[model samples]
Structure formats: C-alpha cells, structure tokens
Target chain A: MRKLLPYPILSLSLLVLWLLLQQSLAIGQILLGAVIAVLAARAFAALEPQQPRARKLGSIFKLAALVIVDVMRSNLAVASIVLRDRHRQQTAGFVVMPLTLRDRSGLAILACIITATPGSAWLEYDSVRGTVLIHVLDLVDEATWVDTIKNRYERLLLEIFQ
Target chain B: MSEVPVWVAALVGGLSILGAAFTLLGCIGLARFNSFYARVHAPTLGTSLGSIAILLASAIYFTVSAQRPAVHEVLILVFISITTPVTLMLLARAALYRDRAESSGDVPLQWGEDIVVERADAPSEG
Candidate 1:
C-alpha cells in the first residue's frame, strides 16, 4: 500500500480531479483515473516537496470562513473607494509587519490570502527579518493591518501548520 | 437552458451580471490607479469574487438545465484562486526589483538596504 500510494491524499485529490474533468464515473474512467493518479502521485513524491501537516481541522475551517467574510467586506469597501471615494485623500502605502509563522506552507497561504483580498497585496518577505512587506490600496492605519494579519490569520495559521 | 425555473434564471442572471460588473470595475481600477502597487490590487477584484460568482452561476445553470450535478466549474475556481496570487506576487516582486535598481523613490528604500545589514547581524545573534 505504501509503495502503491505514497501520498494517499494527493492521489485521492488527483483521482477526483480527473473524474471531475472528465465529468464521468464509469468503471473504465475510474480505472484509468486511478492509474493516472498513482503515477502522478509517484511523480510528485519524487519532487521531495516539504509536506505540510494540518494539525487542527477546526482551525482550518475557521480560517476559511473568516477569509470569506473578510474578502466580501473588503470587496465592498474597495468598490466604494474606487467608485465614490475618488475625491477624498487616500493614503495608499506599503506596510512592513513581522510574522511568527515560519512554515513555508503557512507563509504561502498567507500570501494567497493577502493578495486575494481587494485592498492588500503581498509585496515581499524578508526571511532574515521574519517580516513581510504589503501594499495597501486604501491605507488608513498601518497598525490595523499589522494587527489584522497577526491576530486573525497568522495565529490561526500557526495553530494549523505549526 | 430554456426550461430553467424563474428563480434559478433570476439567480443565474443576477450572479452573471454581478460577476461581469465586478470584473469591469476591476479593469477600471487597474486603469485608474496611479501607482504600480496600487494597480496590482485591481484585478484581484475580478479574480476573487468575480470569478467565483461567474463559476457558481455556470455550475447552477448546468446543474439545473441538465438535472445533474455539474460542479466541475469548481476546478476552475480552485485553479484561479491558487494561480492568480502566484502570478501577481511574481509581478509585484519583479516590479519592486526594477524600481529599486533604478533608485525610484516610489517604493521604500529600506527593503534594499536593510536586508544586507540584517544578514550581516545574523551570525552574531546566533
């Protein structure tokens, strides 16, 4: 079993992806998908990527829910800023915030979250300084951004990843 | 497609229009924003909820019309959500590097200068 399915979760996801893409569930398609999934999983295992362990399933769900709500709220806020607040003075600037979550997967997820939201962009991460540079579209208070990232996302990410 | 219920049709229509409007606004923001970093954030409006809304509409339309689950659109959603950030991050980093090399005052100078000092001090702290 270990030899055939080195990465069980990866193989399962690949199989599901194949089935979804094919939009079929015939026995023949299932057999073919299984073959491809195993082969693909083996290939991926050869890459030796760092495996991320998600320790808290509940935290993961919580993070997803929080991200969705925040994204929706920011979508409206940014839309207003773009449409109605054009005349007002907007302070758009870069924010440098320190982060404690060091897991590569967590950092990657954080980058995705920051960039996916309408108002913020992940510019750079300084590994040596353990800090990230973010660009805010409507920068009101830098401390608020820092607090949001640290308290809301980073803490949950640490719980799940670390 | 023709036999879709009124509510389903309304929902799909509303979602499609919302998605298109958001995408259009994102493009407008892209063009209107003054700076590179600010402009980088514009398309995310389209990529995030815009794409999701459109994909959801497609899924619902197909599912209702065909009388079967047509959730393959979710693959597109997952792919877009994962890939957009990577491309945007790369673009932002490349822009930052170019701006720094040119000594453009638009971005913070500390990014370029502070890395060296931090790296030099790392051994002593350890």
Candidate 2:
C-alpha cells in the first residue's frame, strides 16, 4: 500500500488543493492533478529528507491556535501603526535573546514563530552560543518580548518537536 | 451568485491594492535593510499584515459571494507563518558561512575554528 502510494499524503493533498483551487472534480482534471502529484512526489523522493517527528499532536494543534490568535492581534496592531500619523515615535530596534532550543527543528519552529509575529523578525542566530538576534518593528518592552518568545512559543515547540 | 453590489467589489479591490502595496513595501525593506541582521524584519511585515489583508479579503468575498464558509484560505496564512522564519534562518546561516569564511568585521560568529577558511581574496571578500 505504501509503495503503491509512495507519497501517499503528498499526492492526496496536492490533488485536493488542485480541486480546491479549480473548484472542479471533472474526470480529466482529477487525472491531470493525480499525474502532477505523482510526478512531484517522485521528485520529492530523490531528496530522502528526514521526516519531521511530531511527538505530541494535540499540543501542536493547541500551539497552532495560539500562534494564529497572536498573529492576528499583532497584525491589527501593526496595521494601526502603519496607518497612524505619528512621526514622533521611532518603533524599531534590535534585540538579542538567549535560547534553550538547541534542536534544529525546534529552533526552526521558533524562528518561524518570531518571524510570523508582526512586530518581530528573526535576524541572525549563533548556533554555538545558542543566541538569536532579532529586530522588532515596534519595540515596546524588551523583557516582555523576550519572555513572550521564550515562554509562549519556544516551550511548546520544544515539547512538540524535541 | 446574485447580482454583486458595487460597494463590496470596491472594498475587495481596495483591500487587494493595500495587500499588494504592503508586499511591495516588504520587498523594498528587504532590499534596503543594511545588514542581514536588520533585513529579516522587512519581509515579515509583508507576509503577516500584507498577506492577512489579502486573505481576509478572500475569506470575506468568497463567503459572501459563494454563501458558504471560506475558512480554508487560513491554511495559506498558516503555511506562510510557519515557513518564512525557517527560510530566513537558513539564509542567515548561509550568509554567516560566507562572512566568516572571509573573516569579515564583527560577525558574532562563535562556531569555533575547527573549520579553516583560506583567505584568497581578502580585500574583495570582506
């Protein structure tokens, strides 16, 4: 079964996405989508990358919800700043944070979380030292940002991926 | 689909224009940012706020016009939110590699001297 659908999940998802975008389930379209998916999956197989180990599925979903809410909140906050006429305040600055996430996937997830948040960006990371530099568009409180990143996202990611 | 109202169409058009403008702003920021350390902030603005505006417009318009919940567009937003930083980290690692190889000024690279980098063109590399 696995050999028959060598990239079972990928092929299924690609076909679904194709249908969603085209909003059609015609026989010809399904066949074309299937062919493209299979080809893509074959190309993917050449890489032979390590599969992501998701240890805790429930925690991952919860973390996803948390991230979404935070993203939306920050988006509104950022959009308001862009729309505002205040030229007096300069809201951008750089920050350095000490990190505990030594795992590659965990760190990757942290980087994504920081970058996904509107006010912050993942800059440079020193792997040996386990410290990451970031720039914030709206620098409010440095300690707060540090705490938020460390507690909110990093801990969950460590549990899920590490 | 019923006869589409002009106001809703205009709103969608406006939101789309805003989204595109934000995306352009992000690209400009990416270009203009001085250091790799500073440059990472630019694209996040585009991906977060810029894409949100576009996705919201999509969800709103589709739900209204098609008369159904158009929640699946959230997946794109999720994908971007999760992937952008990962790519940025990889790029930063690559940049750090090149910089350290050239022995550039103050790169904050603490990766140790186990890997030796020959200085062939010192003046140009830095």
Candidate 3:
C-alpha cells in the first residue's frame, strides 16, 4: 500500500479534484482519475517537499470560520472607506509585528489569511527576526492590527500546525 | 431553465448583483487609492467575497436547473482563494523592492530596520 500510494491524502484529494473537473462518476473516468492521481502523487513525492504536520481538526475549522467572518467584515469596511471616506484623510501605513508561529505551513497560511482579507496585505517576512511586514489600508491603530493578527489568527494557526 | 423556482432565481440574481457591486467597488478602490501598497488591497474585495458570491450563485443555479449537485464551482473558489494570496504577495513584495531600490522614503528601510516613514496622519504616540 505504501509503495502504491506514497501520499494517500494527496492522491485522494487529487482524485476527487479530477472527478470534480470531469463532473462524472463513470467507471472509466474513475479508473482514469485514479491512474492520474497516483501518477501525480508520485511526481510530487519526487520533489521531496517538506511534509507539514497539521493537527487539531477542530482548530482548523474554527480558524476557517473566523477567516470567513473577518474577510466579509473587512470587505464592507474597505468598501465604505473607499466610497464614503474618500475625501477624508486616510492613514494607510505598514505594520511590523513579531510572530511566534514558526512552522512553515503556519506562516504560509497566515500569509494567505492576511492577503485575502481586504484592507490588509502581507508584504514580507523576516525569518531571522521572526517578524512580518503587512500593509493596512485603514491604519487606525497599529497595536490593534498587531493584536488582531497575533491573537486572532496566529494563535489558532499555532494550535493547528505547531 | 425557465422552470427554476422564483426563490432560486431571486437568490441567484441577488448574489450576482452583490458580487458585481463588490467587484465594481474593488475597481474603484484600485483607481482611487494613491499608493501601490494601498492599491494592492483593493482587488482582494473582488477576489474574496466577490468571487465566492458569484461562484455560489453559479453552483446553486446549476444545481437547481440540472437537478443535480453542481459543486464544481467550489474548485474554482478553492483555487482562487489559494492563488490570489500568492500573486498579491508577490506583487506587493516586488513593489516594495522597487520602492526600496529607488530609495523612496515612503516604505521602511529594510526587513529588520525600524525606520518607519512618519506621516502627518500617523497616530501620535502616547
């Protein structure tokens, strides 16, 4: 089984993706997708990427829900800022914050969360200093932004990935 | 199809309109924002909720009209949610690198350097 499927979860997800793209569950399509999935998994294994150990399914779900809610709220906030406060003096600036979540996958997920939400963009990460730079569209309070990232996202990500 | 229920039709119409409005707002933000860093945030409005809303509408419309679950729209959502951040991060980093190369005082000095550009609108330190 290990020889046939080096990465079971990756192969399974790839198979599901293939079936979804094909939009069919016929035997022939299943066979073809299975073959492709195994082959793709093998190809990925050859690359020898670092395997990320993600745990705490409950935390993952909570993080996902929080991200969705935050994204929607920021969408409205940014839209109103752009439309209503266009004339007002907006304080847009870069925020520098230190992060304790050292796991690579955790950092990547954090980057995605920061960038996907409107009004904030992840700019850079300094690995040596364990700090990240993010640009906020509405920079009302730098400490608040830092607190949000550390408490809201990083804490959950640490729980899951670390 | 014409046989779609009134509620379904209404839901789809509302979702599409909401998505389009959000996308339009994002475009307006892109044009209105002064700096590159700020402009980088504008399109996220379209990519995040805007794309999800439209994709949800498409999924629902197809599911109802075909009488089968048409959830392939979710694949698009997953792909968009994953790819948008990568592209946006790259763009933002590239812009920052260019600004730094030109010695623009708008951005910070370097990764570890703590020289923040002070602006009139910056909140005063307590």
Candidate 4:
C-alpha cells in the first residue's frame, strides 16, 4: 500500500489538482492523472529526506490562521504603497535575527511563513550561529520584526513540525 | 453568455489588473536587487500576495458567473504558497555552494561537508 502510494496524501492532492485544472473527470483524464501522480510520488521518494513528524495538528492550523491574517494585513499595507506614492518609504534592507528554534522542519516552516508574507522574505540561515537573514519590504522596526518571526511563526512551528 | 453587468465586470477587471501589477512589481524587484541573497525576496511578492489577488479574482468571477462555488483556484494558491519556499531553499543552498566554492567574500565558505557538491559553478547557475 505504501509503495503504490509512497506519498499517498500528496498523490491524492495532485490528482485533485489535476481534476480541478482540467474541469473534467473523463476516464482518460483520471488514468493520466493517476500516472502523473504515481511518477511524481516516486520522484519524491527518491529524495529520502527525513520525514517531518507533526506533534500537534492544531498548532499548524492556528499558525495557518495567523499567517492568513498577517498576509491580508500586509497585502493592504503594500497595496497602499503602490496606490499612493507622494513620499515613498524605501523598505529594502537586511536584518539579522537570532533564533531559538533548532528543529529543521520548524525552521523550514518559518522560512515559508516569512517568504509567503508579502512584506518580508527569508534570505539565509546560518545553522552554526543559529541566526537568520531576512529582507523586509517595510522595515519600520527591527526588534518588532524579529519578535514577530521568532514568537509568532517559529514558536508555533516548533510546536507543530518539531 | 449574456451581457455582463458593468459593476461586476469592472470589479473583475480591476482585481485582475491589480494582480498583474503586483506580479510585475515582483519581477522588477527580482531584476533590480543586486545580490542573489537580495534577489530571493523579490519573487515572493508575485508568488504570495500577487497570486492570491489573482486567485481571489478568479474565484469571485467564476463563482458569480457560473452561479456556483468556484473555489478550486484555492488549490493553486495553496500549491504555490507551499512550494515557493521549498524551491527557494533549494536554489539558495545551490547558490551558497557555488559561492563557497568560488571563495566569495559574502558567503560562508567553511561549513560541514553534509551537502554534496557536484561541481564548482553550481551556485552561479541557480
């Protein structure tokens, strides 16, 4: 069962995505989608990276909700910048953040959370130093940004992905 | 196929235009940023908020026009949101490797040998 659907959840989601994009469920389409999913799963299995173990699914959902709210807020903020440009605020610079979370998966999730937000991006991570480099689109406060990332995203990711 | 309402059409057109504009902004950022590390942040604008606006517009237009729930676009939104960081991480790692090999001053050169390097100029390609 595992071999056939090495990544069972991923395969199923891919199949759904295929159907959604095509907007059809013909037998031929189903077969082709299945084939593609299987091939993609096989490719994934070949990577053999350490699988992420989720400790609390609730934490993940909570994190997602928080991210959604933040993204929406940032979207409006950025849209305003685009819309009104009398005396534009330039928000492009590098910030170094000290991190407490050590789990690889948690750190990876934090990276995604930061990148997915419109106003900030994850630049790099130094494992030995346990620090992260980020670029902010509207970097008004450095300490606040650090606290937001470390407390908001990293803490929750540690609970979930770690 | 009936004549679309002006208000609805205008809303859709506006949202679509906003999405396109954000995407272009992202691309311009991608081009303008100096270093690879700096350039990494630019595309998130397009992949994240930019795509979301477009996806929202799509979902709204289809749901209203077709007179049904047309939220399938959320799938793409989710996919891109999840995958963009993963791809970016891989590219960053590859770039780091190349930078390290070239003995670039900006990147850290002395790290553990855990990452397998296939060639010297790998980072430049990414």
lDDT of 2 at A159: 91
Query: Candidate 3: deviation at residue B45, Å?
Result: 0.6
Q: Residue A105 of candidate 2: its Cα lDDT?
A: 73
Off by over 4 Å in 3: B112-126
Write candidate 1's Cα lDDT for B65-84 as tens digits: 99999999999999998899
Candidate 4 per-residue lDDT over residues A1-162, each given as its tens digit: 888778888898889889888777899999999999899988999999777777887887899899989977776665554444534545556678888888887787788888777667676788998988776766789998888888888888777765
TM-score of each: 0.93, 0.69, 0.93, 0.72
- Model 3 agreement with the true structure over B34-78: per-residue lDDT tens digits: 888889999999998899899999999999999999999999999
By lDDT rank, best first, the candidates go: 3, 1, 4, 2
List DockQ, one per candidate, in order.
0.68, 0.31, 0.70, 0.25
| Clash pairs for candidate 2 | none
Chain B structural similarity as TM-score, candidate 2? 0.76
Query: What is the alpha-carbon interface RMSD for each candidate?
Result: 1.1, 3.9, 1.0, 3.6
In Å, candidate 3's interface RMSD is: 1.0
**Worst 10 contiguous positions by lDDT, candidate 3 chain B:** B112-121
Candidate 1 segments exceeding 4 Å error: A85-89, B110-126
RMSD of each: 3.4, 6.6, 5.7, 7.7
Ranking by DockQ: 3, 1, 2, 4
* Model 1: DockQ vs. true structure: 0.68
The most accurate candidate by lDDT is 3
TM-score of the candidate numbered 4?
0.72
- Report every candidate's CA lDDT: 0.90, 0.74, 0.91, 0.76
